[model samples]
Target: MPEKVIIRSIISPHQRESFTQFIPLSPDMTREIGRTVKEIFDSLGGAALLKSSRDVYVKPNGIDAKAYCYTRPEVVRAVIEYWQSAGARQVYLMENSTQANYTRVVFEVNGYRDICRDTGAIPLYLDEEKTIGFEFTGRKSIYDGDPRGYDRSHCEMPVTVTEKLIRRRDENLYVNVPKLKTHSMAGVTLGIKNQWGFPVHTSRGHDHNYNLPYKLTDVLSLLRPDVTLIEGIEGTVYGHYPVTALADRCVKPFRVLIGSLNVAAADLAGAKILGLDRADVAHLDQAIKRNLTGGVTGLDDIELEGDFSTLENIDILGDKPSSGKYPADLFDFFPWDVKVLKGKELACREGCVNNPLTLLQVLFHDHNGRGGWTLVMGKGFDPDEIDEIQGRVLVAGHCAIEEVAERLVKRLGKKKVYLSGECNDLAATAEAMFHLMKVNPVSFLPRRRGAAVLAFLMARLHGSKSRVPNPLSHLIKMV
Candidate 1:
């Protein structure tokens, strides 16, 4: 029989605290927090998992830390210090930031560098590190209906993993500390969802089979977190990143969830804490279908030991069950399912949008109702309507390209209509829209502009080797 999948929780005494107070976390708080973690860790037999381990790998959820979207460095520091005191040979803090941006930027931008220095830990940017690949047998379901998750091509092709991780022995443990947040694609991001960071991001391109849930299932089966720690000190409601505490959609749910030996179970408890159904999340549902929880049954099956009542009905990003999803009001202008195309049909999936709305949302943030950009996605377009007064029409998918690209471009002129050649690719499409809006997307990022400026000045003044120079800017404002 599989070992029992046990999970527990602790209501942070400071769940009522504000996010802005930057006072140093006191030693008393640290010790108590460490005690809380160690209690849970010991219960999970995490120390035995660490015995004679080649290295201690801490995978904390973040591109960089902001208010509620990342694991608290204090928590990570506590875990590392505990293990170090327990005679860990070496400890390494590792992450691969989203968008393939600079990992060091997050380390510096989020005070992780300081955490590393204080804790005597080293950092690893998985994106820049050496890697190796292994074949994934797609016998597992890789898609919605497809019982087999990946295709023969995916199975035949070697799935690459970081060399540092691939080379480690099975007993060398992986500690997964993920932030608590609702995801747009996966419903809620906790333990299982957080594992997405482990894979090389480029594998997500059109070729590698776009089945995120199944892909994660295969990866988790091979190497999932030995212990899952859900960071709820602070969290976001709808989506991750480019979010502000109050302005975007962030919330503080002063709670921490710990699970022993099962990532899915930990996520199950975390999902309920976020007031989300286990069925609503694709990956969670898929895990059930695959029976990948190491014999742990459903959400009810997991043994819960904590102040469960405290987690009920916490206000998230949206409201009700999805306090974590973005507010629908942001789409009042281009309401989802309202046909903007001439005659194209758009299939609506749960927790997904058709058009590339990233640029629109960002534009709205900077210029809410004033921006003159109108997006018409899907197929079927009336030439007369398309020719009428307009700023730019964003052809969102391949269907639009097939149906309207030529006529629309001929009438509106090449500069007027932007075609996102691929279907439903938000990043590429949003970038195209950014060009139409006369704004560089990079500058919109918090500290990227400052960094670019520094890199430029460095090259100009010091004959720098690289294209751009570095800037001395404050990314970790709170830190």
Candidate 2:
């Protein structure tokens, strides 16, 4: 039988202290987290598992640590101090954020760099270092594809190891330290979300997977760590960006530190603490479906320390569970369903709007030898730019280009103007309706479909026209 999952909670009356002083964290707050880690780990099993560890990797959830969206430095520092006492030879805290600015600056802004230096733990950027790929084996369920039969995928892909934190033949313990926050895509990001930092810089595109919460959890299901610690002191209730925090003053300040042996259990518990619905999160559901947590129901064995009732009072000011009917049965997701794509490819008329799934899909496929597509953007009634190109083009979605269909049929003389993205169904339905009527249908452009539409348009303009089958054709054609 698998070892029993363990979770320990540390509740301090002081945790509820407010940050009225305009600092990111307080000394009292830091000490509280350290005490929590020490208490929980000590009670669950013991510190002996980590006592002789020579190297430690404190993976902090950077989520681009712009401001309120990431794991606070103080929380990580507190953990570092605890690890030092545990006899860890070297402790390294690391993350790779997505902001265009320098990682060092971003780290400093969030006070992570200073915390690392002060605590004698080295700060590293996963993106900048030279990565060595290691083979890993893991499994995932194909609920959307084959039912009644479970499936597995070996995570044996080459993974880049952190060289700076490497120790000689000594048992390595990972302390997953992530900030508590609501995710628009994953539902909630905690320990599992922090593991995305382990891959090489090239694999960066996997994050765009719309079903990232699940995909990420799948990845972690194979490489789960020894423990997880979450910094829930002051988390962004809004999506995972600092700019959004200021523009949208929605964040929850929960003074609780969570520790768990099971990553999913920790996230599920963390979600409740943040007052989020675990079922609503795509990744948590996926992870559970794939048996990533041993079983979500198995969480009954873990201990809960703080007031479970307090979770009810957490006011979610930003990202919250979608009101749409969440899939109760993980197997309910079907093969043809868009959600099965891992990440979705949403088409828009212009490239302005960013669709996390489609963006991630393109990046993953491109990096992993799937296919490379061009980005297109344009408006209706515009002269066809494909005329200048020698290859074929895919109009990912319809835009109000003056008789674009007519133009594709007229000037360009191409029949394969692939329509994908948001309004493809509606546009295709409208086209079918017009085909039934035997006349050109009015161009129906949906809002937020601009990104797909623009990709199509630009592909036409910049000679992105190549006669390749649309990735979403099997799904879209059925519609």
Candidate 3:
């Protein structure tokens, strides 16, 4: 059994200091916070719970480089600072960003690069590391935690996790610092939601799988976290449905949640603080059904240890679409991309808004727009639509690639029309879009062709996305 969960509420968002400024903590304040953190570990085991001879991993929410959506560097730095002071010998900050080969890009852009430099915590990009695949024969499990409800024990689980991270499971501890964000599918992305990053598979680039609910359970069962910290300094509401780009999605909850020895207790506490019902959070409810969260059916089941008086005052906003499906939130995210995604009739049959809308998010967040973007994508466009496109146009997928290649070259110029081979090749698509975006990585480590070939071949051994060769020759130069 885990110790009682702890909730520390910071009502004043404005009073908080620099998110990146690492300063000397007042001895009094440090001791108070440290005492609270020590109790959190005592619930799991003892003060040495984080002490290890090998590398410890501080897993934070860095799904993308987007602002107010991922975990803040200060939150991660606090964890590193605390664990090191608590007798930890070494620690590594790690996470797998969505769909980008360059996990380093996400970390560097989102402030982890500097966090690692100042705190002496190494940054490990999970996707860049080698992966190992496993399948539970008698147990059926999903990777993305699909809410459709599949029996985990009977499903074939081909989940791939970073071998470097998996092998370290027995040698060290993990502190999962998940951001309090509203997920499009699983409702609230709390402690349990953070584990979804372990699997190397994807329902799609967008982070929603039919089996996400169960997939999350499988990951939790596999790599159990010793401490789960939920940060609500900044969050997203109606996260999937954007009203006005970045403004509508973000929220300032001004709070922090801590839990351990049990993942369910931690995430349950997170949902409660957000004023969310346990019944509504699919993975949390599913975790309860399997008796995974120590039989925590709701927040009332867990005991709180710290300041939690303002549970009701917390404003999480709605998780679902507040105003129904709106693409403007996504399109408006980038200033260069003003034409708005047309060809609604051409949305992929798999899921109408999934590919088109998500592609725009991936492109803008991952790359820098030079001339900005004018995207016209999906299966619907008649070749005639190509003539109407302005600025640099990106025609995604092989479906649209065939029609626009020649026309785009002639009208826009050879540099303008970018074609991706696979229909949903986000990596390839990103490489194309970025050529025009002129994205500047935090630091560039130029790799020779031999190095790229060596990395590519090694990835082949691990069944990685690197198995697919990048057509953009310059991408090899970018790394």
lDDT of 3 by residue, 1-479 (tens): 33467776443333344423223334454445445555555655655575445456788888765556577666677678777776777878877665544456556556787788898988776665555554422123334464333323322112223343455566677778888766555667777878766655332332233445656666666666767877665555544322223443344434454655566877766665555666767777777777777666765666667665434444433343442221112333545544545454454422223444454554354333344556655555666666777776666655456555677778888666666544355565556644655543221212233444454455445454321214453343221
The order by descending TM-score is 1, 3, 2
What global local distance difference test value does model 1 have? 0.55
Q: List, residue by residue over 263-320, the lDDT tens digit for candidate 1.
A: 8778776676566766667677777777887766565566655544333453432355
Q: For every model shown, what is its TM-score relative to the native structure?
A: 0.74, 0.58, 0.64
TM-score for candidate 3: 0.64
Query: Judged by lDDT relative to the true structure, which candidate is superior, 2 or 3?
Result: 3
| lDDT tens readout by residue for model 2, 369-408 | 1222222322332253434432223343333222244555
Per-candidate RMSD vs. true structure?
A: 6.9, 13.8, 7.7
Candidate 3 — worst ten consecutive residues by lDDT sum? Answer: 151-160
Q: Which stretches of candidate 2 lie over 4 Å from their true place?
A: 1-22, 99-102, 133-170, 211-214, 242-248, 298-301, 307-479
User: What is the alpha-carbon lDDT for the whole of candidate 3?
Assistant: 0.55
C-alpha RMSD in Å of predicted model 1 compared with the true structure: 6.9
The number of clashing residue pairs in each candidate reads: 23, 35, 17
lDDT of each: 0.55, 0.48, 0.55
